[model samples]
Target: MNYLARDPYAPKRLIEIGEAARGLGVTARTLRYYQDQGLIRSHRLARNVRGYDLAAIEQLKAIVALRAVGLPVAAIRAILVLRDQPDAQVRALRSALAEALREQQAQIQRLAALAEGMASDDAALPPAIAGLQAPSPESATPSKP
Candidate 1:
């Protein structure tokens, strides 16, 4: 279901590049880069002006979201193409999201271990940092026993 195409409120009015970028909390260059990447198309208002309709704005929103989660431009371009194919889009997105979740879970474990080590100020090197045999130059100052 292409919701952007079906939106009844989609105005004929054009949103210029700067406005769209501001609304999306991205730079104008980023929007232009997406156009260059063929992820989204914008209207050519004049020789120097670029514009986007509401549908394209929605598409840009999706692009921004996908990029936020560490997906590269090539991956985003593929996802945008898949939007035209519902079955494939769902399958691809699910696979990407599942992989992201797995990666995030592993990252959380590593960060939690680091945090635990940092939280214990008095401990003689928590297990996570126990491999080190020498303290840094900054830790040369002896600690109280």
Candidate 2:
């Protein structure tokens, strides 16, 4: 068995941070932040410049999508940690999505409750209060003699 054989599916060329950021529709600072948060890893090709492999870019896409849907950094990290295990990864992703859905549903319920309360309060307002309006400029100004 040739252990050194290159996988055909692997990225043939690495891309710099700027290109990766632009391709991902994110800023270089955001990529750096992801690196800092241990969410994604970048290759240090030289003294300061960083590059990313295709796998890294794919990971960034997943991160961005997860974030767009309101998944927190911690949950994203947890999902990433399960990447190596295909079965576990699916389970983890599903669990995270379920949790996010529950949270969104709860938030919607809370907002609906608040809106209903406000509606009831508006209905209960005294007629004078409900009818009150700010005086228009024309009404405020005295009529010329």
- Give me the runs in candidate 1 sitting further than 4 Å from their true place: 1-12, 122-145
- Estimate, for each residue in 1-145, the C-alpha lDDT of model 2 and write its tens digit: 1111133443446677888889988888888888889999876544456778878989999998998887878899988988889899889888999999999999999888666756864356455557989999878975311
Residues 67-98 of candidate 1: C-alpha lDDT, one tens digit per residue: 78866677677767787799999888777777
Give the Å shift of residue 30 in candidate 2.
Answer: 1.9
In order of listing, the candidates' clash counts read 0, 0
Q: List residue ranges in candidate 2 displaced over 4 A.
A: 1-12, 118-145
Question: lDDT, candidate 1, residue 109?
Answer: 100
The alpha-carbon deviation from the true structure for residue 145 of candidate 2, after best TM-score superposition, in angstroms, is 63
